[model samples]
Target: MNLIGIFGTSGFAREVGDIALAQGYQPLYIARDQTELDAWSFAGTAILESEVEIYREIGFAIGIGENAIRQKVARRFAGQLKFINLIHPSATFGQGQRQIVEARQGMIVCAGVRFTNNIQVGDFGVFNLNATIGHDVIVDDFVNIAPGAHISGNVHIGPRCWIGTGAAINQGQGDTKLHIGTDTVIGSGSVVVKACESHSVYVGIPAKKIK
Candidate 1:
């Protein structure tokens, strides 16, 4: 049986393990360091970074939910293990979906994710449970679209962005696309209609900048 090295031990990690199991692979939880490896008492089998080479080549997945941390762990394990995109069987990419122009590896598309046509998804991103992504959308690398979030058409989500849970971003009109700048955080349950700037925080009914 193929073994998947999941790079986290959190509750979300366990959830990702379930997805790995659905993909017909065994979940091998990866701990951050020797301390974590020594103290790990989780249900699944786990190991430290130092022991990855012994397996020769194992499929890897980042079980982390944090965008920056996901990128960090991915880069650290880039040449070590083979990265794999873990998409749940329950996720739907529209009825007759067009192409998803994916750039790199280790994308985690969870249960009930619906993707519309002509979407461009970058590397190491997470489309969480029940999130809806509309047409002509571009999700950059290391982005985390949290559960129940809705991204409308012509949306450009920047790198390392975290679209919070249950948030809704409305569609952009002709000759314009909603551009969310790099490293921005869209707060949970916010309704965004306007473009967001880089390295900022937006939260409200209209999703104004709070930071």
Candidate 2:
């Protein structure tokens, strides 16, 4: 059986291992240091990162949930290891028999996530549990959609954005796309009805810039 190297030693790392198990591949949990190596929850599955040996066709994934850290890890390992997309079994792509138009590698699509048609997803992104994406959405690299977040149609999300838990982004009307600039943060339970600025934090009912 092929082994997938999962970087990180947290509970989420083990959750990613669950995806590997569901896909019938062995999950090799790589620890950053001796402390994590000793504290890893899964017995016989953990190994020090320094002890990693690259095998032909071996795949790697970042099990961490943060967008910035994920991007950092992906960059550090780029061109060195084969990146993989881990889609959970219960996730659905597209609605009404439609499908995602395009997707890239190192994407972690968790259980119950849904993607509507004509969505273009970039590399090394995470779609957390029960998150939904509507049609004509363009998501950039290293974006993280937290659990239960809902993204409506005609939305263009820029790179390294964090869409917090249960946030809802409203759909743009006919030919108008709500643009979320790069490095933005949409706070938890917030409703986004307008375009968001880059490197800012938005929160509240009609998301106002808090930072």
Which of the numbered candidates is closest to the native, going by highest TM-score? 1
How large is the C-alpha RMSD of every model relative to the true structure? 1.7, 2.1
How well does model 2 score by local distance difference test? 0.86
Q: Report the poorest 10 consecutive residues by lDDT, candidate 2.
A: 94-103
Best by lDDT: 1
Cα lDDT listed for each candidate = 0.88, 0.86
Model 1 Cα lDDT, one tens digit per residue, 100-172: 5233589888899889787888888899999999998889899999999999999999999999999999997
- In candidate 2, position 210 carries an lDDT of 96
Tell me each candidate's TM-score: 0.94, 0.93
lDDT of 2 by residue, 22-134 (tens): 88789999898999888876644888888765452688888998889888888877888888888888888765412332236898888888987788888888888899998
What's the true lDDT of residue 136 in model 2?
A: 89
Error of 1 at 157 (Å): 0.2
TM-score of 2: 0.93
Cα TM-score of candidate 1 = 0.94
Number of clashing residue pairs in every model? 0, 0
The count of residue-pair clashes in candidate 1 stands at 0
